[model samples]
Target: MNQSNETTMNPPLNQESVSLEPSANLVRTIAVRERPANPGAWSNTVAFGWRALLKIKYVPEQMFDVLVTPIMFTVMFTYLFGGALAGSTADYLQFLLPGILAQTVVFTSLYTGVTLNTDISKGVYDRFKSMPIWAPSPLVGAMLGDVLRYTGASIIVVLIGLVLGYRPEQGLVGVLLALVLLNVFGFGLGWVFTVLGLILRTPGAVMTISWLVLMPMTFVSNIYVDPATMPDFLQTLVAFNPVTHLVSALRGLMSGGVTLGQLGLSLLTPVILTAVFGPLAMRLYRRKR
Candidate 1:
């Protein structure tokens, strides 16, 4: 019985017994399924953007800054500096809301880099780099996801400003346009920090450097005060500042006086930043260890 069982299990290596070609039924089954097409760049970008949003969803703490800071700035500044600077909270809210919105967008833009840096530190980006998808999709998608954060912060500021007596001369249409412009500018400015994320080894380092740069950039501009109140040298510096242009544009859009030239100036910085640093960030991301 044992010998018979061994003989049945170990069949002879005859041509008929051990055929290399698959059987007809097996071949037919294999041929029925065609290979799926690879996803295009836009699809890849959207997928990564969804993944980024999921990260925010799971880690709700990621949104804390986006929510709290804008509200605090809107409330605190409107009341604290209102009487001294603009004679009343209502008047100050009129002048301050747009500037706060601009500042909120600028400040929130840094998180793109910070989040990117954190992902890198966790070694998650290495896996992203290895994926067989569009090369820039991860970076682009991450920034795209961050655009929503900027929008959320902007909306919060706008709402708080409205609650605190801020009213746009341009109304809802103007408010929407201002938000669009603010987000576009934020998207452009994000490239600078994206480049930083790729270069810096630690998330904290990236954030520190970002703060150092943004501090003077935001404070020296016309966000908090008119450039005319500054010294001539300071005014000259502020005149060149893209933030000043953005704040000016935001004010004009909300309060009714924005010009074509101001819009051009506000847009110039973002275009320049994206043109210069966008490629740099991509290169760094590709070559990063």
Candidate 2:
């Protein structure tokens, strides 16, 4: 055989193929390389979710605000405006309870966008992209995190309401059902906020723009006061506010007096809001890079 033929027969192993070689160093390199950095299911969204949970777990104090805020809001409204709104503390507590539950949840949902903006600005998402993971992991993880958040906020709000003499006629099952609806509502709302965060360049900007959007959605609705008490223009706008439908749904479930029509509106509103915002949010997220 000629020299050229001999060289072809005994070709040298390249760096990539050497990684799979059986020699100790080669094998070690292979193991280091062949092992997927972001492995399995949690590698993507589930991983992100677990990471967020762990972060919160390590920082237990983050939840303190969630627990305390509900109490503060209920107390503020009950003691300050009890007589003005409902004529007595007992009556005010009951009516304000539903309003507090709905408003607290709606406001808390803003964290989704605000937190998302921080993650983006901090280059954390870029790290996720570099890892060996699915595209949907962060989205899945963030959404799951929101579930826990909503649960904590809702439960605390309910408990505070109880301490203040705000008993739901629906009792335990009613409270649970209200929580379920709120959880579902919050879950969908997070997607909208996450997308919003992706579009907004700064966390403060996200909060500012979103608050402007959210405040109107909450106050313009029938949460704290009945729409009939409002001006005609405000009443007309309230008809279109999804928060009104959500509060109505929660109130009906809590009071054991919610009609099918109200329930339908309640469930329908969050879902529709999700649909409208979901696509835009995802579009904004992808458009980033």
Candidate 3:
């Protein structure tokens, strides 16, 4: 009788142990499956960047802004404002080409935010979060891929300018350097837009906000006309404008007369913008979820 009672009690304990074993194994299996592989930052960034490039391949229309817009603006502004602003199209082309390149690259950077916001709204970012890649891979990769657009715009503007008889007296090397500087500035400025994308509700709203901020700066700067020609108040505004310094630096590098002061300011502007906006963007990105 005692043996029977002990056996009955012991059976329950054995069954409990059996049940616990499977539960523990199941938890281990789940943990192993859930743990993602840690690819280093550089490799992850490149992989994600390739994804962005593939997106452009599938949707070639995205190139329109970099391709068509630069051509149209180069032509329109050269003819429309050339004669009035600088006496003739040929003379104006020389002065206007570099400025146009600056404006085109800077303006193009705005789209980075718009596209980012679109991705977030579409739940693409959430999908990314599920992957094992570095948290910042998406954002950094997108921005890196955008360097191509900036380069394309710079090339298109320069090619159009060449066709319009706008010569870069600084030659190929100088033109290349100027392009490098513009891309740097564009990349740094893009971080600010990235932060906006993180916080904004819609892509359209991001674009509108970017335009409102950019238009006034572009119009008031020395991109089109000499700041000296403007009234005192406008000139004062131009004097402090970072765009003005960028244009001046480009003109100097491309036209063979960039001053030390202009070069220093041009280099410093991107550094300052990146320092301030880059961390802000990353912080916002981390808090997104």
lDDT of 2 by residue, 1-289 (tens): 6977866766664454566556776657767745545466665666688877886888888677667777788888788888888789788787768778888888788888887777666577677667667666677587778778888888888877777778789789988998988878887778778877888788889889888988888778877777899999999999988788888888888987888898787778668767887777766766575
Which scores greater on lDDT, model 2 or model 3? 3
Which of 1 and 3 is ahead in TM-score? 1
- Candidate 3, residues 1-289, lDDT tens digits: the string is 9988887879988788888998999889888856566779898888877887998999899889778988998899999999999999899888888888988998999989998887766567777888777787888889988888999989989988888788899899999999999989898888889988999988889999999989987889998898889999999999998889999999999999889999899888889988998888888887786
- TM-scores, one per candidate: 0.87, 0.82, 0.84
Task: Give the residue spans of candidate 3 off by over 4 A.
Answer: 1-38, 122-124, 130-132
Go through the candidates in order and give each one's C-alpha lDDT. Answer: 0.89, 0.79, 0.88
**How does model 3 score by TM-score?**
0.84
Q: Which pairs of residues collide in candidate 3?
A: none
Candidate numbers sorted by lDDT from highest down: 1, 3, 2
Query: Which candidate wins on TM-score?
Result: 1
Q: List model 1 lDDT by residue over 80-148, tens digit each.
A: 988998888888888888989989999999999999987866677778788788898989899999999
Candidate 3 global lDDT: 0.88
Error of 2 at 9 (Å): 45
